[model samples]
Target: MMVGATIIDIGTRKALEANGASIASGALAQANDASYDIVSDGGGCTDAKFIISGTFTTAPTENTTLAVYAQPLDIDGTNDADAPETTRPTVFVGTVQVNNVTSTQYFELLAENVPWKANYYLHNNGTGQTLSAGWKMDVIPYTSSPSA
Candidate 1:
């Protein structure tokens, strides 16, 4: 036996300032063992839905950049050399990954329960080839957390 389902529609609520929507876009960036910022690198809002999509320049080989939701943290007490790297503290609410490097293959990560601290990052681990990519994020603010 199973229970019934319930659904709600969240239309564009421009008049509702607290529940308004927003879009964040980025230009194409080339990478080779480099990281690029996609969304709020150090800031985010709860009760919001995020749709992150992007395209790559060429078909990456077996190893390519990884799309992740992580936070930056102070590694050491005082030394700048001891600071955490760009893609440090990989704390993800969901399994995030970029499947391939093909131009036709784009990556889309849907994060809903994203905390107000996590930031989106794209890590390109390609050794030899440089891959060009661009990313976009659609943020939908909500009054309360949405159901799964």
Candidate 2:
């Protein structure tokens, strides 16, 4: 059976606010993971889209898609130590490693279902030459689509 094109255009209001940090060389940061928070008036209880863009001093070996997500805990809790929460969510968006490491390159991550959290981390699944520094992320939350 074949279904005709529904001509679907999920018109949802979305907005992205830039709130991130930079990771120093050999410094563990909470922003090095996947997760998002509510940035709209509709509340951060729904899923939203994401578009990650930044500059990297070091380039990843392969194409990596860093998962972006939101958690219910404050993973950035510090115990007088500088090491941030290393155990975060990386299932939403994956960081795609490109070959451009000289200049600022843009990375796009489109998420559907987002939640209200306080931490977003970048998940690293491989142990290659680690990236040195220079990285930032942009988060955009949108209203959910209607269910038919």
Candidate 3:
């Protein structure tokens, strides 16, 4: 039985903010609104692990949560250059809550089973906050048996 995991660098160290724009109160913002081609590395994957990590320069209100969601894209035929359909429904993955504090803070979340070729976003559940640059989200595909 040979098991292995492959780290899919779909997107690394992607900024959570757009053009240094701060997330408004109780707003949902896409992580750069970029579409990742998960099919390249997601083939034969039995499961997927998602990791989102970042620091909040402007800390959110105490006890507030940041929710993560993903929407799968529909590719047209075999042409990768064609624009992907973005009308698909989004699925909730997971969320992380903030502690009671007003200073810069770090946070991380781990989720599983996120769909491939999906675009994800963050929903701010409290007052507006500014995320520091260099925030990242990564997806890791796992195979139960590599030799199968």
Candidate 4:
């Protein structure tokens, strides 16, 4: 028997900033502080795609590169908020490059091959650029067939 691949939308396009505040330039912050829990699908997620879309409030002086990362919880399913500072580690998945970004300009980055983990986080590469108040990131995980 073969099961069709299933796609799971982690958080329904959750905003990078929880409070609807602009992400300041030269700052590194987590996307909603592990907002989307990837383990809810019985931990069968094998691959994922990171979708980031939003407008830039403050454009970068030069070409800007935004990097996305994923931070998984401990093997015992310990949340970052409860784990020790030194136990959590983030893995670099991919990046989006914005050239000549302008205010109110819409941009979208679709990064593939992002491994499914316990959780995820978004990091802005601090290129003197700020995302408008409504930036959003969506994580879509693809589950492999049980018999595959």
Please tell me which predicted candidate would have the highest TM-score against the true structure. Answer: 4
The candidate maximizing lDDT is 3
Task: Please tell me which model should have the higher lDDT, number 1 or number 4.
Answer: 4
Score every model by TM-score. 0.42, 0.52, 0.58, 0.60
Across 25-74, the per-residue lDDT of candidate 4 in tens digits comes to: 65444666344444554244445556665566556655676666665555
> Mind giving the per-residue lDDT tens digits that candidate 2 earns over 43-146?
54454445555555566445543444444444355322122344534334444555535466666665655434545554433413343344565555555334
Cα RMSD for candidates in order: 10.1, 6.6, 6.2, 5.7
Q: Order the candidates by TM-score, highest first.
A: 4, 3, 2, 1
| Structure candidate 4, residue pairs in collision | none
True-vs-predicted CA distance for residue 8, candidate 4, Å: 13
Q: List the residue pairs that clash in candidate 1.
A: 60-101
What TM-score number comes out for model 4? 0.60
Relative to the true structure, candidate 1 reaches a TM of 0.42
User: Distance from true position, residue 62, model 2, in Å?
Assistant: 2.9
* lDDT score at residue 66, model 2, on the 0-100 scale: 43
Give all candidates' CA lDDT scores: 0.36, 0.46, 0.54, 0.52
Off by over 4 Å in 1: 1-4, 8-49, 62-65, 72-87, 93-101, 125-133, 141-148
How much is the lDDT of residue 56 in candidate 1? 48
Model 3 clash pairs? none
Segments in model 4 whose C-alpha atoms lie over 4 Å from true places = 1-20, 37-39, 77-89, 103-116, 143-148
